[model samples]
Target: MEEYIVSLNDLKKSYGSKSVLDGVSLHVKKGEIIGYIGPNGAGKSTTIKIMLGIESNYQGEVKLFGQDIAEDSIEYKRKIGYVPEIADLYDNLTGFEYLTFIGELYGLTPQLADYKAKNLMELFGIGEVYHSRIASYSKGMRQKLLIISSLLHNPELLFFDEPINGLDANSVMIFKEIMTQLAAQGKTIFYSSHIMDVVEKISSRIILLNNGKIAADGTIEELKQINQEGSSLEQIFNELTGFNEHQAIGAKFVSIVEEM
Candidate 1:
């Protein structure tokens, strides 16, 4: 019997008059690479926040490793790794220092943290800037540092939001390889991204969220069956989410200005 690493039931959140999540439920099993896809304001981040115990004021239950997260938030958090969209880091700290700080917070020894940080920085091709202040790093470099920090603790469950956002082709390929390797090692990963191609190529299962609700959840073929579009994940996404790229307000505005 496979263990469920993450389980949510009727998870919901609201801010003032606006409800961000509405009865969202999901379950992730051990060694599963679940790709969570949704457009802007579709409540994807909210769900992740709740799961990570970053936002506790929500309705419903969250469980990790078969233990209730609400009862033991810190314990559950220690077992999970998170890399958010905005890779915020301490400007004054060097890349190595920042990673060391996070590892210590997770109870890793200073020497061990430094060792892991060095290897990860090298693997991500950011070792040259390991001693540089985070403020001096580029967007891609900062993103890589953040990923290294997340993995320093060797977490059993990982949450990645746009993990390859600023990465180049080679780095992106490396990340995909790492994700596959992690899954093969019996670790569960929750990947959230707007990149349909990456998700299609890597995810063992995909969950599509639309209007704060689950529109589809299954493998690529199953999703195609649901919408009857066998083209690709991109086509299935557009058809199911009803998000059109061609119809843009900026494009229409520019056209009107040109005509005038």
Candidate 2:
């Protein structure tokens, strides 16, 4: 039997009368790279927040490594690394200082934390600016620091939301390679992104969410077969999510702009 590292059972979240996630359920096995794609406002971030134990008011059960997350939040969190969509960091601190702080939080010794932080920064080509304040770094530089911090502890599972937002082409390539290697080492990854091509190429399986529900879940080839012959992941996504009218919407906006 395959061991599932993460499981969500009939998960539901709401704010008053507004339903953000409605009976969402899924299971991820070890070494699986799941591409979690959805249109904006489709509850992707909400679901992630619930899984990471950041939102405790939701209804349903989330288990990590066969243990209920609510039973022990600290232990659950210790087994996972998360890279949120937003790069929220202390701008007053230098890159090295920030990473060292994160390392300490994860229970690493000061000497080991400093060594790993410096080595990782060197790998990402940011060692030269390690002493510079985060406020002085570019967006891409900050993102690199964030990625390093998330991976410094070598968690068993990773959750990445729009991780390629500020990365250049070369850095994006490097990031993809790193993800592939991590999966090969039996690390489970939940990757959420708007870049269909990258997700289609990298994900072992894809899950499409819409209107607080899972619209489709399958391999890329399976989803394409369900949509149409020779359909790309983008086309399959559009068909499932009712976003095929975007081109028409864009044209209408252009015409309206011209009149203005």
**Whole-model Cα lDDT per candidate?**
0.88, 0.91
Most TM-score-accurate candidate: 2
TM-score of structure candidate 2: 0.96
Clash number for candidate 2: 0
Cα lDDT over the full model 1: 0.88
Tens digit per residue, CA lDDT, model 1, 27-94: 88899999999889999998988888788789998889998887886788888899998855799999
- Report how far off residue 124 is in candidate 2 (Å): 1.0
Model 2 misplacement above 4 A: none
The lDDT leader among the candidates is: 2
**Which pairs of residues have clashing backbones in candidate 2?**
none
TM-scores for every predicted model: 0.93, 0.96
Can you write out model 2's per-residue Cα lDDT over 36-138, one digit (the tens) per residue? 9999999999998887888879888998999888897887787788999996799999988999999999999888889999999998888998999999999
